[model samples]
Target chain A: MFLLQLRNELRKLFGKKRTYLGFGMFLLAQSAFILVLKYGRGPNQSMMRMMQGNGYAAAHFFSNLTVATTTLLATAYVLLPLYVSLVGGDLVAKEAEDGTLRMILSRPISRLRILLIKWLAGVVFSLILILAFAVFGACFSRLFFPEGGLFVSIPWDGVFGVFEGVEGWQRYAAAHLVLTLKACTIMSLAFMFSCFDIKPAAATIVAISLVFISKIMQDTPYFHDMQGWFFTYHMNVWVYFFAAPIPWWKVGESLSILAGFNLTFFLIGSTAFQIRDFKS
Target chain B: MISLRNVRKNFGGQRAVEDLDLQVPAGEIFGLLGHNGAGKSTAIGMMLGQVWPTAGEIRICGHDIISQRQAALRKVGAIFETPVFYDYLSGWRNLEILSHYSAPTSRHRIGEVVEWVGLTGREHSRVRTYSHGMRTRLALAQALLPQPELLILDEPGDGLDPEGIHEMRLTILRLHREMGLTILLSSHLLNEVQQLCTRIAVMKKGRKVFDGPLSAINKSQSWIRLRVNDFPSAVELLRRERLITDEREGSLIAVAPGSGTEHVVRCLVAQGISVYEIAPQEQTLEDSYLDLMKFDGPAPSGKQQLQPSVLATEH
Candidate 1:
């Protein structure tokens, strides 16, 4: 029964023109940016200089682009969250705006189940967007720079880290798997806000604002003691995928905290929605 | 069967529906009538479980709405104030998606219902392209899709033309007569309900003011019809003795106060007029409603104040 409802939600989610808007934006950005990175001359020298130790000496084929490290990270940090939040923020709030929420709730289905189906659909969409990012960013960047060892750098600590002699395919696949977790977590937060009485655009704006605020607080030296508590800190856990040996413990801890965040938000949204009067 | 016990709803500090206890039996077309701000919509909302009742118990087909929400809702179908749909999708797809929650429904049933509501030709059009009346029809189609035993419709005639209103009346009548579908329709359109419903309840400022079989309010014993041997003598004798106050259409419509049917017959017969037949015709529902609206005295307690004798003398 729930599967049927989820299928319906997915249909409504994809039917709107706005759903394709984000994907189109990503395709354009990835193609245009990768074009300059590959063909542009003097600019490439400054970028390649960031390569530590040998300094682009043993670079594979042309230079620094690896699906796991460079292109994927560029898309993941900004574009993915904006797009995921759009659909996630729309899941329930759109029904309310359309005045169809009353009709849907009047059915025999439980309120929690109805929302769960929508949330799951949003999670599926979020995962699809990230996976597509990995594929498109990897394949598109490959046209410019040859497949090479992944280039990874920690924030502020510009000390470079490289994964050499490792199969790029295996590393690329692992990085996407971790990225899916991050996408699902951010999308779920947006979905929780969508359950409120506000409009979908407002919900999307609020979700994105929370992400930006967390990112800022995590970067600030004043919030060092509470750094681990911010979701923005954990959502970047995919970066660990490019380390010399995958830090399984850090990945596991980060994923657990995100799972906890998803559960808490889902609970709060469901309770608030069930108690609200649709007529009001 | 639908029952509401001590139902009350308060918005912030103001009350919307106050201590409303309504019970409508199965297979009856019940009209819930009220003017603007009469809490008609609010009462319907509580029945549909869209608004939480501040204090009460509502049961549909023996299932409590609060504790057994799914069970209670299974037998119920409804349309709130206005019809709303996904404007992006065709009307057909909207129904297809909504029917998923009410599982085991068929594509054949969907097609049949759309046709039933007269949307057969335009079912494939996007809802945004539809006019208000078409959207209302689509809402009706959605409500009928569940094949519910209890249908609660709020202002179902708001967007209809005169002909459409006539068709809607027939459709509701057919649903009740043919399918045995019990309906509770809330509206301010007096004539619509007066022509269609078997029973009705009126609301005033968040409180239920009157409820009873329509006949109780519309029927009048004072307006008697009679076919006599001599028309002139009967009229003259009744007028001379002052037995009737008003006469119309070859009948005494309003009998004089302190006079009964027996007195009129005796007066006419004593003057050599033979009375053949006598029958009472009713005033329209409009007349009864107007009278109720103007009354500034005590209110009734549910059905207790609905005694036939008390209502019969209001005129």
Candidate 2:
């Protein structure tokens, strides 16, 4: 049954026109970013040049790529949530709105099982989106830089750091993995909002609103006391992976919090969906 | 078999269904007849365990709908007002998704049901491309994929062409006769229900006003038409003799409830009226339904008075 559901989810993700829209947006954004980095001599190139003067070298070039890619993917902090929202938001609400819930619910399976399948499908879609970003980001970044190590320039602290002498492939792989996990957390949050709303637009709005609101609140002085608990505060936790010696404590805490958020919201979504009247 | 005992449902303070009790026997076709907002959908929802009843018990195949929902739902298949499918998926793929919920249904069964609903050649076509009738057939195909014991169809014939309606009727009859699947169908189309259902329940304002065999309900009222050369004199003669109470329908006079053709013919001829035609009017399910619901208050005591001949057919 689970396999059947997985197959159905995969089919829906691949077959729907909207799925291609998401991929198209990702391609467009990645290409534009690559163009700016290679030909436009944008802020990223200026930063790279400044880091090079501060004792940065080829051994740490991947580290610079990671920072640049992470900054570029932040744009997805807005775009990807909308995509996730469109898919997940329709998980249950679309069925109800379209009057398909009645036929789906009439099957022998329990409502919990149906909801679990939908939630899992949403997660799978989210995973695919993250993977797309990681793969595209890597191709674009490598095209422009063509270097072996990342040069990190911290403007605020007046310090220059480099992951010198590290294997470029390993650094890029680790950076992509960390960014993918961070995007997973955001996608999961958007999915939770989707479960609560019947309208795809409404779900997307709410999910994006939460992310943007949390970002603003984390930076606000009044919200200083609650910064550590906000999911947005840890959105940059992937940066810790690039830090020398790696801040395992902050990394583990952020991962744990994100995991907890995912589980909590997934559970809430399944429960509400299981009990909700399928009638629109 | 499905049974509802004193089922009541409310949305906020407004009652959607109230004190509704009905039992649909195994392998029989039971029609639920009502107007818009008559709580037919709500009742179906509660029976399917999609919506909780504010109060009452719904049992499907002897399993409680609330406490043992999965077991109850296991024996049921439903098609709500419209055909709902993943528009992006092929018709075959939609059925494949539903097949997961039931006992491991085989590909052969899926193919069989697809053919049964007459979608064999179009099974691979995306559902978004299907016509309304085709979608309806696909929805019915999905419902039958599980081979459930009970089928609850709400307005299954709505939007269907005459040919589609005929095909649906045949399909439903086959399910009952060959598969022995009990069916609870709700529709506003009176003639279809009249032709299909063995038993029916009628609702008005969220309350059940009539329930029992179709014959008994139809037998409660009768109409007779008397055509006379001197229409006014014949009408006055019939009224004076108290043989038939009537109202005008064009030049023809329609007699009231108990007036039989034989009685009207005898009375009119004895009164020296020139009777052109004395025919027994066919009492339709619609007329019977209107008569049943005509009363503003509680139904008058004792089985509604009908002519002896009508009573004879009723029993």
Candidate 3:
């Protein structure tokens, strides 16, 4: 039944013309980011001069591009929520809007099964979108800056370090994986919101608003007491992977908190969807 | 079999369905007759478990709709209003998705239902391009794909043309005759219900005023049509005798319930009125329905009041 539902979800995602809108936007954004990183001149040159003055080699271009690409991708967090909303928002609401809920619920399968399938399918789509971003970012960064070195900047610590030696690839891969996981957590939250709302647009707006508001609130001194509970405070947990010795304690706490949020929201969503009347 | 006992539904503060009690026997087509706001759709929605009833019980095949929803729903199939489907997917694929939700249905069964609905040649076509009639057929195909015990169809023939209506009627008859599927069809069209359903329940303002076998309901009312040569004198004589309540169409007089056709003919002849034809009209389901509605209260606007026996026999 799970395989059957997954197949159906895949068909709906690819079969409908509306599904392409999200993918198209992702491609366009990635292309624009790549173009700016490749041809545009900015603080990269100024930082390179400072690095050169500090006796760093020019071969550290790849490390600089990695930093640029990471920052650019991070700044483009808008796409993450949009991608999650596109798929997640339509999980159950679309079925009701289309008048297919009656046909689906009339079947022998339990409501729990349907919710599980839709949630999993939404997760799968979210994962695919994140992977697409990672692949595009990696290719574009490599094209502009092919030389290998490690130029790490600690934004919160107000310090910069350059490691021009072997084992740079390991560090880059580790950092990329951690960043992907962080984005996955955001996608999962958006999906849970999708299951709760009836309108796709409304669900999308709510998901984006939650992330945007939390981020803004976490930066405020007035919200100092509430910052620990905000998902936004842990949004930068990916930075721990880039630390010299890798702060396992902070990373573990962030992962645990994210996992807890994901599980709690998923449970609430499934329970509500299972029992709620789906008349639209 | 499907049964609803004291089922009531409220939207905000307004009552959509009130104390609705219905029992549809297995292998029988029960018609739900009502005006636009007569709570037919609300009752059907609750039966399908799409909306929870504010009060009372709905049981399908002996399973409670609220407590044992999956089990009750497993035996039911329904089509509400327009036949909405995934326009991008082919007709065959749409059925496949619905089939996955139910029990594991085979590809051969899908092909069979497609053939059953006369969409064999066009099964591969995208549903978006299909006409309204074709979509209705596809919807019926999907509903029947699960081979459910009970079928709930709301205005199934609403958008069909003459030939489409004929074809739909034949298809519905085939389902009941061959497949032995119990059907509960709701429609405001009296003639359609008379032709299809053996029993019917009529709703007026969220209340069922009449519920019984179609034949019995039709038989409950008496109609007398008299054709007299002296139309004015016959009308005057019947009015003076208080034998008839209304007269219309110049030559035809509609007599009251207690006045027999023979007695009216005798009185007309005694009054020197030449009686051409005097016969008791066979009270049709439509006539009985109109009479019932008139006694209950004024029917809501735009209600289709079908003609009596003539229309039923002619068709």
Candidate 4:
């Protein structure tokens, strides 16, 4: 029964034009980034200089895997949260505003089940959005860059890694998989706000605003000691996949905290939705 | 099939439905009539489990709405106030989606219901392309999708042209007469209610001002209809004798309740005026509804009010 209803929910979700906005935006952004990397000399010079300073052959590191991984890092932080929040915020609030929630609730199904199904649908959408990002990155990179070794560096985090052969591609896939966790977390936050008596846009805006604020607080030197408490800090757990030997412990801790966050968001959202009156 | 006991709903400090105890028996078409904000929609909402009652219990088909809501709503289908749908989806898809919430309905059944509500050819069209009348029909189709034993419709004829209203009325009547389904319809369209419902309850403010069979409204007034050969002479005699207070058409007379039919007949015959027909004049539903709207006091507990009688006499 859950699967049946989830299918129905997915149909409703994908039937709307707004749900495809993320896919389109990612396609455009990835294509543009690849085009600039191919045509612009400044970015290549900076990359070559950074590689030389770190003592690696710059040409060997400028691979399809490197470009794709870099594209995910550059775009996932900003674009992923925005699009996931947009979809999650609309899952429930839009229906309420449109007056369709009343009719839907008029059925024999419990409100809790409906909320669960919708939340699960949002999670699925987040996963699909991340998958699309990965696919687009790989395709656009292959179109312009040659396949070679992988090089990744986040200077502020004091991380630089190099890998060749199957290990780099394996890490690349794992990174995209872990990136889904970040998308789901932001989506859940927006979904919680969506259950409240607010408009869809307001829900999305509030969710995105909270993410930005958390990110800023995490970056602040004053809150450096409490980094583990901020979701924005834990959201960077995917970046660890690019680390040498991989920090499994850090990944596990971040995953546990995010799983807890997801549960709490679902609980709060289901409760609010259960108690709300569909007076519209 | 439907019952409410002392149900009350308050939005903030404002009362939407107060002490509303109503029963709609099996296989009866019950009309819920009220003006705007009279809480007809609110009461229907409670019955549908859309609005939680501030006090009291509502049961549908012997299932308690609060504790056994799914069970209660299992046999009930409704369209409260406006019939809203997913405008992006086609009518067929909307019905297909809505029908999945209950027992799975087959595509053949969906097509049959589409034709039942006169949306056969247009079921493939997007709801946004549908007019108000088509939307109402689509709402009817979805409500019938569950093959509900009890159908609660709030203002089904609202925003429809006369022809559309007529079609909706016919569909409702067919559902009741053919399917033997119990119906609780809420509307301010008195004529439509009068034609479709066998029993009705009228709401005022947030309370039930009157409830009984359709015959009770007309019976509240003790009026006698009369026809005479000499219309003017009979009218003059009756007026002079102070028996008839109002005249109707060319010959009919509104005999006062104080004067018996015997006295009016005796006086008219004594004046050599031949009486053609004499019977109690039945009031229209409109007349009874207007009379109830003029009522100023709370309804008697657990009893249908006959206050409209006094108001009818005053009329």
In candidate 4, what are the lDDT values of residues A1-280, reduced to their tens digit?
A: 6787888889899989999999999888888877777788988678778877888887888878888888788888899899999999999999999888888888888888889889999999989988888888988899888988889998766567899969998888898899899999999999999999999999999999999999999999999999998998888888888999788998999999999998999899888887776675
Candidate 4: tens digits of C-alpha lDDT, residues B1-315: 999999999998999999998989999999998898898888887887778899998999999988998898887778766788888889999998888888778999999999888898899998999999889989988899998999988888878899988988998889988998999999888999999998888898999888888887766645566777788888888888988776755745666657788999899888888988988767798966776787756663223436323453544
| Alpha carbon lDDT at B46, candidate 4 | 81
Question: TM-score for model 2?
Answer: 0.87
In angstroms, how far off is A71's CA in candidate 3?
A: 5.3
TM-score of chain B of 4: 0.81
Q: Write the per-residue lDDT of candidate 1 for residues A1-280, one digit (tens) a residue.
A: 7777888888888888998887888878888777776667754654566553446553562343453346566777788889888888888888888778889888888888898988888888877777776678777877667766766666562224565545556666787888887778777888888888899998899999999899999989999889898998888777776665777898899989988998988998898788877772
**lDDT per residue, candidate 1, B57-171, as tens digits?**
8898789888888888887888766788888899998998888877757889999999888999899999999988788888888888988899888888887788877877888
**After best superposition, candidate 3 residue B124: deviation in angstroms?**
3.2
lDDT of 3 by residue, A11-63 (tens): 87679777667667776776666566556677456556755776776555445
Query: Docking quality tier of candidate 2?
Result: medium
- List per-candidate RMSD values in Å: 6.3, 4.3, 5.1, 4.4
TM-score of each: 0.84, 0.87, 0.85, 0.89
Better of 1 and 2 by DockQ: 2
Calculate DockQ per candidate and list them.
0.48, 0.55, 0.54, 0.55
Which segments of candidate 2 are over 4 A away from where they belong?
Answer: A58-73, A152-161, A164-175, A178-181, B226-280, B293-315
lDDT of 2 at B258: 57
Candidate 4 residue spans exceeding 4 A from truth? B222-282, B300-305, B308-315
Write candidate 2's Cα lDDT for A62-135 as tens digits: 34365455445455556765666667666666666666667777776787777777767777777777777767
